[model samples]
Target: MAGPDLTLDQARQQANLAFTASGTEFAFGDAAALPLPIAQMKALSAGSPGVETLHDGGLTAEVLCLKHAGRRWAVKRARPVCRVRNIEGQTSFLNELQRHAELAGLRLPGVIRPVYGSLRDGLVVSPWISGRHPGVLDERQARTLLETGCALIEHGFFEWDYSAGNLLDDGERIWLYDFGYCYRFDPLTQFNSAGHGCEHPRHHLAERIEGRHLFGALLDAGNDDEALPHFIRFKRLAAQAYVDLADRLARRGATPPVLGHYRGLAARWHQELAHAPGLLYLASAWQAHSSDLDDDLRGRSCTPRTLQRAQWLQATLGAQGHRLRRSGALSPDDAALDDTALLRRYHDREVEARRCQL
Candidate 1:
């Protein structure tokens, strides 16, 4: 009566099949009617008068702002050799192009659409988005990001990286312009595009946002009093969003664990929001910082935040490790480590982070 459930890798292959078959190059709409002439757009050098090099953008690509015919467009040229030196980094541009096609077809909100791209040419062109990466998010920005993330999940796209560079805020809504790390999975039966999909149940939309953005933003808050309020607000929003997400998935015939995962998170967050919000904040912050720190280390693309996260982990283990243990914040492997060992590990990581600074 129905097709068999697919593994995460299978799902990804199916999703990108057409793109692969079509030689992995794509251009949306009539190229003849494109906003900028593709030849001229590609030919323009970084030092050209009207071309502005935004930043190195690190590892995968370089972006330039092109002022053509009075309109600004962002021209992203993939590096001949990706700096991150991993399979994911090497293939990120093609993955992004695939996601752009999928998202454009879905007409998903809060995502900036690219006008043209070619994998072979190592180029992607989209209208320049006028926005800033805000260190701290207000309610509107936070809610918008949550909604966009939920939409991606509900539609089977798992966005792994929500780093500051991937998001932009135009004073009203947050825009997701980077899909380099986003992948597809069977949302009806899988948690994410990792470890056979459902094996890593702890990874989810809220977890990603916290690990990649929220906790980093909270790092700026001078004290618990300043940060607690923001965490509380985010927890409240995320809990409700999960509940709503669970309901939508249930209607789509999602599996029990998938349903329970969101429901459990919502219930726990709600309970904590009422009684032990501080514990919730502490446990989540510890987990977030630690997870992101590991990601940076594994990628060998550490940033200043990686050092900060490592220091936070060291300080937390030294000061509140017992509480972390009680709160079940430590991973099973981490739980085995004594406070001294944990502190030493993080201290070493901090040094490694300094060496790998991007």
Candidate 2:
């Protein structure tokens, strides 16, 4: 395996980016988006932030439901220490502050509007909308997700995390809240902030959804079978989103090569959607399964999906491993395992991963 994308010294510097306690005032981005003044927000966060409506996972910070004036808001106070422990986790809060600072005043439908944020005070306050975390992503939700995701990429921000916990639908629109994992990248040239950029262009917006949100839902046999239709729906939406995205990028004066790069994946997916939906499904499944499993193995944050992916790989190898292998779907490690050894390996890993799950 190659070394980490960053040098050891760079990693150390990144890992040290913890939140500091200072009296630095929360910079209010949109006072109009807030129900209360900056003083009220400061007071609410001066101590343990109140929990009017609780949130599940912050990983990098403590999230609370803030009650101010006659409204509720989300106050994400940076924990003195982050739960994620990695360089991304260590710097996530600071990264969020930076992203929010850029997106503060933008009137984007899919992005959460921040009322206030700060580096020293270690928190951000945004209006609390009564929203639902989607289960089976409906057509509107799927379309909105790709639309917004493309928008972020076009604007030079690469949002890395798209897990269910980070998204909310207020019935009218979908909103992206967490920016701790979102980083700045060249929209016109880079594939993502992960160093793939245009060099490895396959990792686009739809792939992010599959890894972070969709595939986890397809945890078992029944859901896995159902995933085909869900994926098709997303692909359809994404095709249209790409069309709009390419036009917008061109208008923004993106270079022709960059514009061509943006349009290439979309055009291919569109053609496949028209002529060979099944091929697209197989390709997508292979990519999603391979990518997500590697993510778990690397992070070692295995959930049921880790087990499911392993099982799926074993099944695919038995049935059509040759075909998948020819198509570059099977990883070198996966290709090396015999049936008995693979099952045995997955079972052991599954047992270990289960302990980490709940």
Candidate 3:
């Protein structure tokens, strides 16, 4: 007789088999009893009543609904490809969930409450907060939301993937979701302020804001001229917040990867400021292309050549627009002066100059 077709149990068994073959442990659980409390789920769902597909972005499966217990939540399941063929991809996802759990209570989205399976066949659940996109908010509202989101990250010592889609606004409040890639920073590299990697990822930001109708609406609201300046200032403040938190982490002797990551980040911010000065004010020109900063800043793969070009652009733009100042104090000839200080200074000078000009 041929082998029996796999039922849910059989499928789960297969999943376990696959995980074991891949040198990982696979433990099964009662699906009905999730790690998170049913009460917490009900409170989060606010009586939404049933599971509904919120997003099917192809990479992951997402279901939004109120559990039978009356709590709102989001359940995320990796695609079969991730489970079977791309185990490493699943490992990243699992790592993300673990990080989220560790970083809970930082006013960030809740943790990935593991449910019903080992790492290979698990479901991750988090609270569902209803909100609109930042691009949809009015100028004042958008700025406030962005500031709040950044502030949350600052306090949490967590770096969020700031792509537009991960941010949501629900009329009165803005919410950030999708914490699978979040990580803690080392205080030393993070606090140095002159280290690298402080710059926001432009490509991710661009992807978030592009094609959002609300972005166009914001641009058309007679405030297109101010958006770029607002965003630049926002980014600077956010970077500083990260630096401060990272410094704290460093003092505690955080992990090497975490320290290195923030160091790289601080450096990036400095480099961007020294090089791509035009990008600082690009948001103001949004109306001309009907594209918001988030959309326009995507996929900015930088290299030595691109860095040189950005620096040239900065010099060229500095002749017309205001200049950015270096932030923290440094020796006049410190070769160790990484790009971070220069960028912070540049941001400070530019913002101050713009304020005066306005």
Best by TM-score: 1
TM-score pick, better of 1 and 3: 1
**Model 3 Cα displacement at 349 (Å)?**
33
Candidate 3, which segments miss by more than 4 Å at Cα? 1-49, 83-90, 105-118, 136-160, 170-173, 190-226, 229-279, 283-358
lDDT of 2 by residue, 202-307 (tens): 6677788877777666553254456777778888887778778889878878777677766787898889888877667766777777677767777778777677
Q: List where candidate 1 sits over 4 angstroms from the true fold.
A: 1-27
- Model 2 clash pairs? 191-197
Q: Estimate the overall C-alpha local distance difference test score of candidate 2.
A: 0.71
Answer with 1 or 2, whichever has the higher TM-score. Answer: 1
Tens digit per residue, CA lDDT, model 1, 30-95:
455445677776676788768866668567988888877888888888888888675566567878
**Winning model by lDDT:** 1
Give me the runs in candidate 2 sitting further than 4 Å from their true place.
1-50, 220-224, 332-352, 355-358
Could you estimate the TM-score for every candidate? 0.92, 0.82, 0.46
Give the lDDT of residue 167 in candidate 2. 89
- Model 3, position 67, has a per-residue lDDT of 49
Q: Can you write out model 3's per-residue Cα lDDT over 1-358, one digit (the tens) per residue?
A: 1144533223433553465568774343344666355444333332344655456552443445444456555666555455223332445455455455554434443222333333545455555565555653545555544455434434433433444566666665556556544444323333211113234322222223332333343344445345545544544543554465457666776656655555565566556656763454342232222222212233222223223223323343344332222322122442254455544544444333333321
The local distance difference test score of model 1 is: 0.83
